[model samples]
Target: MIEADRISKTYARGVYALRDLSLRIDKGDFVFLTGPSGAGKSTLLRLLLRRDVPSEGQLIVGGRNLAELTPRQVQAYRRSLGFVFQDFKLLQNKTVLQNVALVPRVLGMPPSQQQRRTFQVLKWVGLQHRMSAYPLELSGGEQQRVAIARAIVNDPVIILADEPTGNLDPDLSLEIMNLFREINARGTTVVVATHDRELIRRVGRRSVTLNHGQIAELA
Candidate 1:
């Protein structure tokens, strides 16, 4: 679960990115954060990822308060989370298999286990057949699937996606959203920040719409 307790993020010169916002997302929930650019969507996501701490209040994920974690605790906490981006950040030089296997390898999973896990997730995302392909060699949609595979390689408890369909066409965006829905069905919490209203309506998940750094609407 994610709980933002009246959190506020103040940027340079006291600009408020998030202003005393509070929210709760339960486990296994799939929620969309939609708003205009700079509506504090990304800022809230950054705080949830612990990339940036709130200027005031707290963020708690799975009962852990982000503000009080030790550095090592922070790293461990992050391990339980997955993040996807608007841009597929796969290493250009790496094969699809290598890219998906990265996190397991980094954690010193034995090479054999890493290969198994990588193959498993790649199959999960329907990219098992593209294992030998490089990022540039794949289509845009395929690259995004590879990115999704990489993100879920750890079997994270929560999946946080930032504009995941921003670069895809309408059809491809729906395909990606379907994949997310499947992931959510398996019980991982999913939070997506996107600007596509049509996509949001199609997904028809509960939504939180922000305006000027506050919760302006909920649907």
Candidate 2:
């Protein structure tokens, strides 16, 4: 469902975030992206999400070229994929339900349908009881669960998570990982970028490792 061919990103001052990296992820496959800091994992994720374009080569999603897409098309393409971030980028001022409902609302979904999906996904993430709580009122793990709910509420075909377990303890991290595994088992393609070696080992899926802007290993 996703393909990157010789993709590279070079910023100003000669810093290359990614270098000639090519990878393919098929539909319903779960893959782990792992590397040290400054290893270009985040850059790769950004390219996939169209948050940043590669300075060289091609990125194709669902058979559409990301490099050639217009802004409107990029937005439309993103609607097919879900993104989770390390920081849990929830709106502090919005209630959990409202925050989870934002994307469907933007797509002009009916109120009843949006509410139904939001509640269902929040429940799946084990945060249904916290639906009315604001971000600050919840613990770190709870906030991350809310973020997960928001990502999957649309039932996107691909789920991309950048360091989704970075801030939690081992037990809590395992809980979140199990949630991701469940989603992957249900036929959603799951790609997670993380530095947690133990977690990666525990999960035991194929992993692509980036080092010095290039893919140093893949297993």
Candidate 3:
């Protein structure tokens, strides 16, 4: 669950990315964040991930106030969340299995557990056959699926995807969305930031629209 209370993010020279933004996302919920460019959707996600700090107000994720966390605790907190990006962000040279396995490997998971989790998530994303392939060898949709696989391999409590389907064709976009929905159904909170209105309408999930760095609508 996430709670943002009047949170505002201001960059150097006093440019505000978000202003007095307040929102709450409950556990086991799926929410869509839709907004125009410069509307602060991405900024909000960054704040939630502790990648950036709000210049004002408070952000509490999974019951801990983000502002109060120690550097070590911030690292630990991020382990409970997953992030997918508009760009796949896969290592060009790493094989599919290795890419998905990196998170657990860094966390000091045993080799056996890492292998098992890597295979399981790749299978979940329908990429079991491509585990040995490199990122360049896979199609765009396939690469994106691998990214999703990597994101979920840790069994994160929440998944935050920013324009997850931006590079795929319509069918593939829907496929990716369905995968997120399936993940949500399994009790992981999912929040996606996208500009694709038709996709938003098609999915029919609760959507919060931002305009000028504020919540313009929530439906």
lDDT of 2 by residue, 90-143 (tens): 999999999999989998899999999999999999889998999999998999
The lDDT of each candidate is: 0.93, 0.93, 0.94
Cα lDDT of model 3 by residue, 5-36, tens digit: 99999998999999999999999899999999
Regions of model 1 farther than 4 Å from truth: none
Q: What are the clashing pairs of model 3? A: none
- lDDT tens digits, residue span 60-98, model 1: 999989998999998998899989999989899999999
Of the two candidates 2 and 3, the one with more favorable lDDT, higher being better, is 3
**Candidate 3: TM-score?**
0.99
lDDT of 3 at 148: 94
Residue 190 error, candidate 2, Å: 0.8
Q: How far is candidate 2 from the true structure (C-alpha RMSD, Å)?
A: 0.8
The segments of candidate 2 whose C-alpha lies over 4 angstroms from its true place after superposition are: none
Q: Which stretches of candidate 3 lie over 4 Å from their true place?
A: none
lDDT of 2: 0.93
Against the true structure, what is each candidate's TM-score? 0.98, 0.98, 0.99
| Ranking of candidates on lDDT, top first | 3, 1, 2
Ranking of predictions according to TM-score: 3, 1, 2
